[model samples]
Target: MSDIAAPRSSSRARNLKGGGRNRSGQTNFELYSWLFMRLSGLALVVLVLGHLFTNLMLGDGINGLDFAFVAGKWASPLWQVWDLLMLWLAMLHGTNGMRTIINDYAEKDQTRFWLKALLLTASIVIVVLGTLVIFTFDPCLDPHSTLSVCQ
Candidate 1:
């Protein structure tokens, strides 16, 4: 039998040359994204823990929760800022994580494009609405408001 060599596929050849050429030439985009993920994750842990401690461990704890409780909390600029940071960080972190997953799993370019578009739209809407609610929230806005806390 004569010795024979198998031909290398184009993909195998590309792999041998290192996969750096396939990038879209965005300088340090992935590096920034990776750093953001780590920093945001750490911030989220601290924010979430503080939020839980305040809501679930202070005062009457779970029994103290109600509309009036929320109104009182939002009345303070400190609490409002804390909650706003938590909301924005959580939403952005989740959106970025989902985008990474879509890029990894969605094989079709069209599918990936649409998925990311939808994700961005949803993230924007939620962030905008949440921000508005946090800033515009007024417990005493309505003169006819029935809430005892509002009075």
Candidate 2:
């Protein structure tokens, strides 16, 4: 018999890698991140599709989308919360994906660190601004605004 092991089947090859066994000092960050990507992607699909349907198919369709329509929609607490959730999930999901890409492509530790730092800073800025806009939105910015919400 040859000293080298025989070629294994796909299942056997997969079993070679550690499966469900927790090794000391090994964090499960990657696993959790992978899971989060899947869950957030599913949620985003639902949120985006619902938003599109509400905006394009309901009411006056595409023509109804004006400043007043936006003001009216944002005036509701429910729509505010919905938009807030969508903004947060989309930002986080996209950031996580970009982080993964940086990790995979960047060769040096310093390069990875800088790239991730930039990504994190940008993500934080966007999420904070978006959340603030969603919660603090005022449809009646102008005193003479004709929007019904303004009245």
Give all candidates' CA lDDT scores. 0.87, 0.87
Model 2 clashing residue pairs (backbone): none
Q: Mind giving the per-residue lDDT tens digits that candidate 1 earns over 20-42?
A: 54333335667777999999999
Candidate 2 lowest-lDDT run of ten: 16-25
For 10-126, candidate 2 gives per-residue lDDT tens digits of 445555455742344345778988999999999999999999999999988999998788788887888888899999999989999999899999999999999999999999999
Segments of candidate 1 deviating more than 4 angstroms: 1-24, 146-150
Model 1 vs. true fold: TM: 0.76
- Candidate achieving the largest TM-score: 2
The clash number for model 2 is: 0
The global Cα lDDT (0 to 1) of model 2 is 0.87
RMSD of each: 9.3, 9.0
For each candidate in turn, the TM-score is 0.76, 0.78
Cα error of candidate 2 at position 5, Å: 39
